[model samples]
Target: MTTSAIKPLTVLFFFLAVSLRGTNGEPCGTSSIQVQTINTGETAAGGDSVFEVQVKNLCPCSVRNVRVDGGGFATTVGVDETMFRPVDGGVYLVNSGEPIPSMGAVSFRYAWDHFFQMTPRSLEVDGQC
Candidate 1:
């Protein structure tokens, strides 16, 4: 084949190889949300304290349907009241309803009321099939 023809074929093969190697559609993995403090060790009768949780997308691909559960706390308060609620809480559902880019992260702050107790929080992030 002519040198010019060979060049195009080589370029095409290279492009395909690179694209295949790119990170995409990876499986969901567990990533810890850094909790500054798990518990304050103080309980009030009618007051609340703020807590912070970090959610990270550790997968090589984007993640979607991210849901965070307060774990043991949820069972105590029930599902309706267990969702994270803070006046200025950073934890929230991604409104875009799209994938969280790989390695991207978001922080959430929640107000734990007297009725709510601090517990290990778990995050469930769904990925595209």
Candidate 2:
């Protein structure tokens, strides 16, 4: 290809890459949310296991109304409602429907016989994006 043609192609490819990286400030999706559970080295009074759960938003923009699948979730220890609230059958809301800033995380503790499988179910991108 001619030098001029190659230059324009290079520039076009550069812009395409930037746009794919969300240069337009588009919000990320639920897939960017990470949920991790770990043993906290403590046991509940009922002999259940204690675990710490951290829900992190890996997006560049803030997110609100983060929901997770809490199927069969139970805890002997009470978790703060503002941090994690059980709304319906096996569904929970995180951060009280407030914005979790970009790359921020929310955490809570629970005691149960076993760790429940929690996954990001849904979320709304905050307007700050």
Candidate 3:
């Protein structure tokens, strides 16, 4: 085979190997992610304040389909960021729509119409690569 043909073949094989190795749902390590509260529980009266949570992606690979589920928040009107979609059943799921790169972060801002406890009982990240 000519040198030029071998070059393309070698590159293809290298990419194929990388893709195969990154399979098995282990490319994005869930343990590498960290969630922190960015808000100090502001007082709200009909859309006056908000509660914020930030998720940092520390995985080696990009994390896609990142969703944040909030539990135990009684009155969550909406989210500040457009990337997040709030469900009707007190579940704020963030559809990143793109991959969260390594060492990158995505934050969710909760907008409430009434004054209530902003503490979420659980903040879970259902992210997939």
Which candidate gets the maximum lDDT versus the true structure? Answer: 2
Write candidate 3's Cα lDDT for 1-129 as tens digits.
999999999999877766534444355444565666655467555745676666676666666655444555544455554555555465454444466677788776665544333222222233543
TM-score of each: 0.39, 0.81, 0.51
Quick one: how many clashes does candidate 3 have?
A: 0
Query: Best candidate, TM-score-wise?
Result: 2
Better of 1 and 3 by lDDT: 3
Cα lDDT, all candidates? 0.44, 0.88, 0.56
Predicted structure 3: lDDT: 0.56
lDDT of the structure predicted as candidate 1 = 0.44
Which should have the higher lDDT, number 1 or number 2? Answer: 2
Candidate 2 displacement at residue 44 in angstroms: 1.1
> Which of candidates 1 and 3 reaches a greater TM-score?
3
Clashing pairs in 3: none
> lDDT score of model 2?
0.88
Let me know the TM-score candidate 2 reaches against the reference structure. 0.81
